[model samples]
Target chain A: MRLVTTNLTFAEVQPKLREVVDTLFKTVPAGVGSKGFLKISVPQFKQVMEEGVKWAVDNGYGWEDDLKNTEGYGKIEWADASKVSDKAITRGINQLGTLGSGNHYLEVQVAHAANIFDEKYAKACGITTPEQVVIMVHCGSRGFGHQVGTDYLKIFEDAMRRYGISVPDRELSCAPFSSREGQDYYKAMACAANMAFTNRQVIMHRIREAFSKVFQRSAEELEMNLVYDVAHNIAKVEKYKIDGSWKEVVVHRKGSTRAFGPGNHELSSRYQEIGQPVIIGGSMETGSYLLVGTKKAEEETFGSTAHGSGRTMSRAQAKREVRGEQLQKAMESKGIYVKAVSMPGLAEEAGLAYKDIDEVIDTLDRAGISKKVVALKPVGNVKG
Target chain B: MKQKYKFFDDIATADAAFEAYGKDLPELFTNAALATFSVMADLKKVAPKAKKKIVLKNPKAEGLLFDFIQELIYLKDAEYMLFSKFTVKVADGKLTATAFGEHINPEKHQLLTDVKAMTLHMYSVQQTKSGWKAFIILDT
Candidate 1:
């Protein structure tokens, strides 16, 4: 997930919400078979796999500061393009600068003054004024990641038989982290991670262009600074104090994300005083939250927190309960303007399908995993 | 009577799940392709404007099914194509097929979710009383 704060307020963008959404929907391709604007060759795409957002910035896709705001500077240093398969490269080469379908979205939100929980953290993170307009993008490495996973899962399943390892479920296939197969998968997965960062960075560039076109101002003049970008369901090596000694282990956070607290050396200089920003995206109808990591999380939860409001209902059930067109009309009546490519797709993501986000965040907060900084209510959305 | 395919409501919550049925191996493979593509687009709206051929060999019928669906998804992502109609033949562990569809046009096709990959969770191919049945869970 990634968030960007603009100088414009919600009141300023509300009247032009439809136009803004339309502009974004046109600029950012969504839904099945959505292709990107940039067309790079397979070799050039390999450079992207290794270099991540650096390649984007160097190629004029984004600004230098975008690197700073991104997690791991928007690139995984250990990523190896050679470890990535030809099929994975083929799947990802054309998918940059696009928003994919199914629960992925780009939303325009407002940070109401009453919703601001900690003014100090909010101000530090560029939420200085009431009704501050922000953009949140929820997507990931696209088909490239999926292919990498498919390739490795097959390899690991085969490796398990050779290594005399057994699991009850085939989906839980694994190879020891120290094994060659495991290391190859790790490096290949890093390449996919880089691909995702570059993907979002390229999309961010498109978003900046869209906002500039709609508002009639340069992105810099609009102060479209990216607050932060983070990933979920990723595993990385971290040092944790276990028993009497500090041990380095590969922490696989499925359906969770890193919530490193303040003063942690892992944090970039910009976020050293404050903790890592944890973006918790809720359903499009309900609001989302901006929270900072806590020291307690590092001690108790392996520096991790929840990824999002867990789904309470399945997609088919949601579609059975809600009609997309009716849901759209209802949201418009409730002041949330939305543009969707497919109605059935829209119904599948109805807010009723998700759990109460406030309750989820409250649980995290009470446990000191993260602290609330700001609450953002949706005003406009481009649903994928 | 055997239906071509049907989507399941509770099998996989976050992704898509479906079951495809056929009287034999070839029909089963063809119906599986149909079921997989149906998740990404409306078959009726996707005109068969072009054709492509596929030939794959896997010792296991289940592996062949997985590869067949994976190939379709790969084409969707790599070539920007969606196939609504398929003609498949599976013989002696070798599978060959032809798929027909057009390049996806946002204006022409009622495109839905992109089926990213096939998953191993609850994925199976079995023979029932009347026909061959296969269960698939696609990661969207």
Candidate 2:
């Protein structure tokens, strides 16, 4: 998500945004063999799994207040480091503060005044003008999360037979929620969730550094505070009304965001009166959005909302439809500076490959799942 | 002979899916490994300059094959290597394979995307009229 600042116009920072994108692109490439900004030992990696965003801030990667703005205060409780496998720890050891490939990006955007729906909410988020600049960092737990999922799939598959459970598809392998295998997987997943939070926190720190270097101003001067961060892919145990009775259930929101309404205790006090901030990331060429959870969302849909514009075409088809160079030029023509490691990778994420973000958000708004707070137009992007 | 492996774009809604064919289980698994790497980088450019030995065991053939491909993905992220050639041997629900590739050279190998892990969604390994076949999906 982007940091809100005053009087930062697209024209003034266009050059700087381009430079930042170029630097980030060169610094973080896609796929294997790419180097990360931070290097940590095995012990430090364990700390990341245990502490999440708090670990990043303690390591001087971010401010302490940044945790307050993050979901779950930047750390999920019950994340047992012992649950994480040695392979997962090894994969995460060196990949901290790095942005991985395929649709993961860091973009510089402006909140257009005309698109601001709720002035008070926008101001509360520190955005007071159309010229206000924010940097959206999109990444996750990297290979650490991947390894955790891979490890659990095998474990769950094996446990299914022991528990006399069978599914039509192997992907649906499972164990009883209260079973040992289930609890262990949950703990391991929480570790990955923390890894993702820390991953974004570290990347935000790097973004701040890049801005500081380019503008010759401190992050504090820029008011580069995190507005809010939400985890889209994960499961959480929460109490929700089911059949007129409150029931404790696990909500698995894959490609969705938790949009708890106003007065929800889980939200930070600053945003408790309004709602949890939800960041919706779009393609490199298309713009993004900032929304707030609603009471209706709580009553319906399990307080969930769409995470992004969503893909309309397959990657292979996207690559076949548009050449990367052509897509890059098209994005440039639209005044969006793009820095990428591979042309094919760039082409695979062409804006046309996704649904219109405005339409998707409109649907959410109409459904009362979430209400739009501000619209952010991308000016610069670094793709992996 | 029919092609050893080929990718199907729509087989998965959000992943890369492929079908590997072989006259035997070993050849089927070998082609599956090749298909997996091909999704990560251009296999032709991945030189056979480095060799890594992978051993995996499972009570089921499908599970063994899944683990075999997952090991390759692990090596890609852990060792930063990309393999284009493989000599796989499967016996008694165990896999022993010698994977040949080199360290990822960004200049030489144009990476398409990172293959994070193999997904069991619609995963299958079966004997066919021709020989054996495996269907696999990779989470990117």
Candidate 3:
């Protein structure tokens, strides 16, 4: 997930909601089999797997400061392009800068002054003004990441047999971390991770350009700064005090985010005092939250917190309960304009389909895992 | 009652789960392909403007079913095509399929979820007293 705050406010953007969303929808491809504007080849895409957002910045798609605000500087050092499969490359090569479907989206939100829970942290993260309009995007490595997982699941299933391992379920198929297959999977996963970082960076570039066009101001003049970029599902090797001694272990964060507290060396210097930023994306109809990591989280939960206000209803049930047209009309009545590729897809992402965002954020804040900084309510969205 | 497939309401929360039925392997494979693509596009509206031949082999019937559906997904991403019609033949551990579809034009097709990968979670292919059945959970 990523959030980019701008100098513009809700009042300034309210009238141009449809035009802004349409411009964004056109700039960034969404929906099934969405292809990007970049026409790079397999070999060029290999460089993307290795370099991450650095490739985007070097290719004139992003600002240099974006590197410092992004997790891992937008690249995974262990990424090895050779470890990635040809099929994975083929799927991901044409998928850069896409928002993708099934709950993934790019929303224009307003950070209400009253919603600021921690004024210090909110200001520190570049969210200062009342009703500040910001862009929040929820996406990931796309098909490339899925294909890597799929390839390894098949490989690990066979490797488990060779290793004489038994698991309760097929999804638990595994190989020792030191094994060749495990190392291969990790390297391949890193490649996908890098590609994902680049994917968001490319999308960010298009977002800046679109805002510039719609608002008739340069992205820099508009102060369209990326607040932070984080990965929801990723595994990283980190050091922790285990049994009184610091040890390095692989921490897998599935459906979770890394909430590294203040003073952690991993965080960028700009956030050294505040802590790592955490973006919890709720359903499009509701809103999302900006948070800062807590020391308690680092000590108790391995610096981890919930990724989002998870679904309360399944897609099939959501579609049955709500009509897409009705939901769209209802949202418009409430001042949230939305553009979707498919109606049924829109119905599946109804706000009622998800748990309450306030309750979820309150739970996290009360647990001392992450401190709420600001609450951003959506004004417009481009759904994939 | 006879049906090609039915989506489950509770099996998978973040993904789509379904069961495809057929009287035999060929029909089962074809129905599975249709079920998979239906998650991506409105099959009735996706015109068959192009065609592709797929050949795959796996010793396990379950693995064969996995590969067959996976191939269609592969094409969806690699070729930007959505297949609505399919024909399949399985013999001597080899499966051959002919799929028909067209380039994804948003104006013509109502594109839905982007089915990324097929998961082995609750995945099964079996022969029943009445027909062949397979349960699949697709990652979106």
Candidate 4:
């Protein structure tokens, strides 16, 4: 029931998290290049880049406090409107609230504890039913992000060569936090990060409407509430236990999620006992999970864990190798209803193309990075 | 001969450069649009009955060729047609191309991910001693 800005940091909802996660994803927009419920003008879009979820809420999309529970309270500290190019703006103008495609999506799931920890968290999050529905939304900044990344890559790459930085991979090109190039990238990235947060917020509002339309009930009656939200893709300058003095380190979480442990002020006061909630989205066919950050996370991975089941094949390769109709038939057999803008997209995101999420969870758990809280099974899904 | 990159241009829904480079930059940038139209239908069968003189602005010489090919892909996707051949000149992000193509079928073709769009992902244009090279990542 809370807006994500202030209180819900991943800590308090550990118990009922699986149900929360399953229920949440069903509403949020996700999938590679999934479009949003609405569009905004470039000016308004710029506001989104600047204000994050608050901008959407101010525009009548969400609650004022929703930003409180959100990471960075939706607005990134380093966002720079100037850093975004006109082409990026052009690409993003019509796509402000879109989900985009690929692993991004909105899915409905159910959580029942097969394990004690899962059960405990489910109870705490008020997810009492083993068959309770949950939603999961997996997405980033969409085309805006792509453009930002692309736009910045050239700048940073040129800067890298200018500054004489040699990295193993072109994709890994980055500048130091103190450098001018680094500063520019950070500012631009913040803009994208804020847009991503706002994008999810707008998508969540649309989800509420979709639910109300389908179920014929008010959102409040359905008890659709945001459990927690965290972003792991961007890098941040934060206080970490570096040399035990909480030195500032630039933590880059690519394809990862921040798993801040219990007792941090970032979490809602109520959730301080459990820790920040960690959301892990799996492929559409397999399922997802809701977990709590561990104190040990600070030591292992800078309080981060895997983002989703990483892609096993490129989309082009997927299209070249797989068929859409056959892929849809397989999903239907498993009782997961599917709808999409493109059949080829369904084939591209075929469940077989990813690593087993169950195994991924096992590795995370065994690795002691993020502990498992609850497991979700899919019911309905839509992808682009 | 056929590059694996999905797309090179951002908004490719109309008339655009369709580079299909194979062994050389000139050829690769020239044929991308042709390859794109082929995806819509049979390029060999299309009589090139409809011809249009077209040009586009590519931001970079190498990426511009990539963008040209993506433009052809966009046209095919939106028009359900194909363009067989093109001649292009790329400099300082601007591309001028003369393209000839025709309408065709889709069901007979194998459609890949309806590319939502393309953005510079691993987009690079390099010239080797033997030929030209480029890599593109399309958001499917």
Highest-lDDT candidate: 3
Question: What's the residue-level lDDT of A103 in candidate 1?
Answer: 85
Rank candidates by DockQ, best first. Answer: 3, 1, 2, 4
Worst 10-residue stretch by lDDT in candidate 3 chain A?
A: A168-177
**Model 1, runs deviating above 4 Å:** none
Instruction: Report every candidate's CA lDDT.
Output: 0.90, 0.85, 0.92, 0.64
Model 3: docking quality category: high
Lowest lDDT 10-residue stretch of candidate 4 chain A: A1-10
Q: Each candidate's TM vs. the true structure?
A: 0.98, 0.97, 0.99, 0.78
**iRMSD, all candidates:** 1.1, 1.3, 1.0, 9.3
Of the two candidates 3 and 4, the one with more favorable lDDT, higher being better, is: 3
The superposed Cα distance between candidate 3 and the true structure at residue B12, in angstroms, equals: 1.0
Writing each residue's lDDT as its tens digit, candidate 3 over A1-384 gives: 999999998999998889999999999998998889998988789989999999999989999999999999999999898988898888888899998999899999999999999899999999989989999999999988988888889999999999999887787778988899989989999999888889999999999999999999999999999999999999888888888989888899989999999999988899999999999999999999999998999888888999999998999899999999999999999999999988899999999999999999999999999999999999998987
Highest DockQ against the true fold, candidate: 3
Residue A29, model 2: lDDT of 49
Candidate 4 error regions (>4 Å)? A1-37, A113-116, A313-322, B1-20, B32-87, B91-94, B98-133, B137-140
Q: What would the per-residue lDDT of candidate 4 be over residues B1-140, giving only the tens digit for each residue?
A: 45622443323321111223356555667654544443333456666667656577656676566456555544443343456666666556677777676654333333223333444445567776656655544444
As a whole number from 0 to 100, the lDDT of residue A26 in candidate 2 is 62
